[model samples]
Target: MSKVKLFSYWRSSCSYRVRIALNLKAIPHEYVTINLVKDGGEQKKDHFLKINPFGFIPSLEVNGDNNQKSIIFESLAIIDYLENINPEPSLYPKDLIDRANAIAITESINSGIQPLQNLFVLAEIENLGGNKDQWAKQLITKKFKSLENIMTKTAGKYCIGDTITIADVFLVPQVYNAYRYGVDMSQYPTIERVNKLLEEHEAFKAAHPSVQPDAPKQ
Candidate 1:
């Protein structure tokens, strides 16, 4: 069995996605918390940058059977790796078109919505005297509106169908962020419904930010 270590921040949507994937695949891993805000963000520090040059959370370090070490960054790439290694209870659809639709949903959130409102981007907005909350709310609301339309057509019980796909993995965290940013989820009933069902799922519950080791005590 490969030894896996995950360097993650509790509240990062990217990290959250990977956590759900790991739990869903029942992959054993050591969780190392990287406080993104403490001491000016641990992810930007030299030691962590060595693991992931991009200074991103959810860096996966894998020591293979032959004792070769490999590091993977980026939530989508890490999840893809997990899916490749553990094929059962797959996080993607079996049908070709369904799979494509699932991937499309993942990309929509990964590239289209997430990047615009990440910590660094929001901090930069504040640096320029912009209201970070308002910026995030507007962007999330707009993208979520589009996602709701897509979900209306594709969803059955989860994001892409009754089976939970990579789309659900990506969707849950973004919806959490939407709630945090006050996006008024009622406008996106399909999204809200899917999110509600996912939140009750064991894998999703285990991966939720509030339950993470690094989350603030309440």
Candidate 2:
């Protein structure tokens, strides 16, 4: 079996999600840092563009036994691929309703919120003379409120039940982003609680942005 290669930025939330999944599944992979902030974004380079036409971070390169290599882009899609290939530490519930619920929660954060405040979007906002911090704060706060309400019914030690799921993978990164932009976490008790609990997990700790190989020195 050839090694898996993960292209990621240290502080990117999407990248963080994939790291958590990889760690949880105990899949060993090479970590390649694509500094999104350096040199007008290294992700836009030709080589990276070939891997992912969209030039996004967290493009996963999977090498097969036959030596063939394939790349997967998009955080959720890459995570789903990992889950499919590795079923042991299952990240989804067996029941149909529960599985769908987990996906719903994951999408709410991955699609509904994360995109709006991504680096590119924030950069665009700043280029247009908008206050990027204020923009992120408002958007994250609004989405977190909705997330808090949904989590009230869905959580149990972790989001969607006792065991961790893809929802938890999706949640922690967004919660980190919320706090980074100064969005008060106190308003979302369930999210805060779940995040606090999940933070103690080894996989979560291993995947934290601060500890990544490419994380900037403080």
Candidate 3:
């Protein structure tokens, strides 16, 4: 087995997704907390930037056989690598059409919703005299409406079918962000219903932001 280390922040949605994937795969790893907000964002510092030029949270360092080291950035890429290495208890569906649907849901949240309300983007909005909170809430609500529609058709016990897949992996964190921005989840019944079930699952519960080592004590 490879030695894995995850560079993460407690409340980062992207980081949260990777954590769930690791837990679901039962991959042993070291968690290194990089406080995203402290000291003007630790992820932006030179040392961390050296690890990931994008200065993003959820960087995965894998030390495989022969001591060769590789770093992976971006939540989806990290999850895909983990899925590839640990194919059992797969995070993707076997059916090609089902897999495509799962990927569609994942990318919808990854590229469509997440980036719009990211910290940097919200900060930029604030600097432009825009209401960041309102902006985030509106954007999340709009996207979630679409997600609800998609999930309504594809969902079973999980995002694609009875089995958990990449769709559920992406859904959980984005829904977390939706709650953070005060987006009313009731309107998206399908999303809210599936997220409720995922939240209770052991792997998802273990990877929640509030339970992370770096989470602020309440």
Candidate 4:
């Protein structure tokens, strides 16, 4: 097994998703905190930029073969790499169609929803003299409405049937963002239920933002 190190911020939804994937796969890793909001965002610093040119959280550093290091940025790419290397207890379905469905659901959150309401995007909205909260409310509500309908069909004990897949990894973190932005989850019963169910899982619980090592001392 290679050494794994995760560069993450405690409250980043992307970071949270990767954390759950690592814990769910029982991959041993070291957590290196990158305080996203501290010192005008540590992620923008040269040190972290060297690791991720995009200066994003949740960059996974893998060390193998004479301790040669390879870094993967972007949440889905990191999760895919992890799944490829650690195939036991797979997070993706073996069937081709089911795998596509899983990736579809994952992308709906990872790309369709997250980018519009990302911290950087929100900041840009504010700078443009737009109301950030209202923007988030509108975008998240619209996207989650689509997600809820998708989940209604795909979910069974977990997203895309009874087995936990990459879809669930993406789901839980976005749900956290939903509540944070005060999106009315009451309308999305299936999504709400799945998020609640996944939260109870040991791995998901361990990866929650509040419990992270770098979480605010509250």
The residue-by-residue lDDT of candidate 2 on 26-72, one tens digit each, is 98899999989888999999988887788978999997557778888
Better of 1 and 2 by TM-score: 1
- Model 3: CA > 4 A from native: none
Error of 4 at 12 (Å): 0.5
Q: Candidate 4: lDDT of 23?
A: 94
Q: CA RMSD for every model? A: 1.2, 1.3, 1.2, 1.3
The whole-model lDDT of each prediction reads 0.92, 0.92, 0.92, 0.91
Candidate 1 residues 182-204, lDDT tens each?
99999999999999999999999
Looking at candidate 2, what is the lDDT of residue 59?
93
RMSD of 3: 1.2
Runs off by more than 4 Å, candidate 4? none
Between prediction 2 and prediction 4, the one with superior lDDT is 2
Worst 10 residues of 4 by lDDT: 63-72
For candidate 3, the TM-score is: 0.96
Q: What is the lDDT of residue 174 in candidate 1?
A: 96
